[model samples]
Target: MFMNIYPKAYISSLSDVKADYFKEKGIKGLILDLDNTIIPWKAAILQPEMADLLKGYQASGLNLCVVSNAFNRRVVGLLEPLGIPGVAWARKPRRKSFLKAMDILGTTPAETAVVGDQLFTDIWGGNRLGLYTVLVIPISKKEFFGTRFVRLLEKFVLNRLAKKGVIEIPE
Candidate 1:
């Protein structure tokens, strides 16, 4: 169960991700979590740095799609100008939305990766689908109420993974 929830990589933020690294790993597509992963939770604006990075990834030939639990309006508001496709109210940790994102990318699991701030949703869901998972620290402390509860459990799991050397926790 723990292995199933473990992420392939853990990083401070999305800015750490490099298109070249994914290319080397044969990942042609990216399934991204929108809220706290790309922007602050519930934020409609995409930061200039993040926007540039995402554009850079596209320029590097990586297909990208946002799979978000937020409402359709929220997702559309943020991604439309960028011309990125997305699915809203994804109910992730479930495989359906993840599969749908892959279909949109036209890439198989072997050629895809998932990047998000949540372990239960993003990491576990992506791992279940056999896609590489990269867990990033949430961009802000603000999030859904339910997510706060999940974060408690996530902390425990992260600590355990760190002690077992499955991953090294950042100080």
Candidate 2:
């Protein structure tokens, strides 16, 4: 478990995620988390910035879909205008949702990347399924109590990586 594994992982800010970066990394498809990753958890509407960014990625020929654990219809509604179909009640960390997203995108595991803000749900699930994983800092620190607890573990992992120089915290 302490193996110095080569990272099929990366940490990035939401603002720093670019189409070119994905293209350069040879990622042909993206599986995105909805809440906190694209918008704050409480937000029912997609921010214009996120809409534009999604358009940019789509325009670059990157297949994109929102894969979220949220079962809310409002969450699914928000993604429709972006013309990207989404899967809610994704039940992530379970492999089923990730596999479903890949099926929708028509891409295999090697061609896909999963982008989200949580470690337990997003990273663990993606890594398990053999898709490249990107862990973004949550847009808002406030979350459900259970999520807050998982976040504590996330910070522990991040801190350990920082201390080892395996990952550098942004200035």
Candidate 3:
């Protein structure tokens, strides 16, 4: 069960994420999942509110970076103008890419938080690496074929945790 596996998991929405939350939580860096967490999957354009949210984090002295499994240049290119460096092909659920992002941010796992929409990849990877893990509802329910399959598994895990009262679903 995800609860037995990772006891400190949290589920939230991108809009609900506030700079003060991170500050109060003592997070100095953030490893953000680009695809549905920051923008809709396969969408090249960033929403204005999303951009403002990222800016808010930056303004609060928090280091932020996109850590995505996306390998396409087009997908990676979209984030360049945001003025933050990113690590594409992150291969999440694997620790190497998370470590690389941490190295780039010049922070340790203790001082970092990983925010993403997927439970298996993002949350698992972050928790395994000892970073605070936050799971956000995907911006869009539509997903790629492979991602849809992973989401099925993620839902199973979430359900199990919820039944055990270890994971609370956000309102």
Candidate 4:
């Protein structure tokens, strides 16, 4: 289970992602998590730096799809202007929604990357579908009660993986 949740790379933030490396590896699509991954939980829009990075990535020819567990209105309102496709209430660690996002992005799992701050949801779901998984530190410590609970489990898994020398990145 721990191995299944191990991310290919752990970085401080989305900006740390080496887009060229993923592009070189044939990753052509991005399955993005909207909240802590792109902005703080209550943030209304993307941060300027984040917006710049995402726009740059898109301009590089990679398609992006937002796959978040947030309500449809929340995700849709945020991604609408970008015209990015998305799936909301996308129960993660489940294959269906992830698969749907990939399909909408027109890429197979092998050619896609899933980016988020959670191990159980983003990493597990992406790894389950054979997509490259990238884990970024959450933008803020604030979280809902359920996510706070999951974060405890995520910490345990991350600690174990670190002890096993799997998570070597400095984040």
RMSD of each: 2.3, 2.8, 2.7, 2.2
Off by over 4 Å in 2: 1-7, 167-171
Q: What is the C-alpha local distance difference test score of candidate 2?
A: 0.80
Please give each candidate's TM-score: 0.92, 0.89, 0.87, 0.89
Per-residue lDDT tens digits for candidate 1, residues 1-171, read 554888888788878768987899899999999988999987869999999999999999999999998899989989998999999999989999999999999999999999998888899999998998988889999877877888988888887887888973323
Candidate 4: lDDT of 10?
78
Q: lDDT (CA) for every model shown? A: 0.90, 0.80, 0.80, 0.86
The TM-score of candidate 3 is: 0.87
Scanning candidate 3 in windows of ten residues, the lowest lDDT window is: 1-10
Q: Which lDDT tens digits does candidate 3 get at residues 1-171?
A: 343234254555667767777777788999999888999887878988988889888998999888898985855687777888788888888899899989988888888988888777888889888998888878887777777787777778777877898864434
In the range 86-109, model 2's lDDT, one tens digit per residue, is 988988877898999899999989
Q: Which structure is stronger by lDDT: 1 or 3?
A: 1
> Which ten residues in a row are the worst by lDDT in model 1?
162-171
Clash number by candidate, in order:
0, 0, 0, 0
Clashing pairs in 1: none
- Candidate 4 residues 1-171, lDDT tens each? 455888987778888765686798799999999889998986888777887888889988888999998889888888887788879999998999999998899998899999999998899899998998988889988888778888888788777887888874633
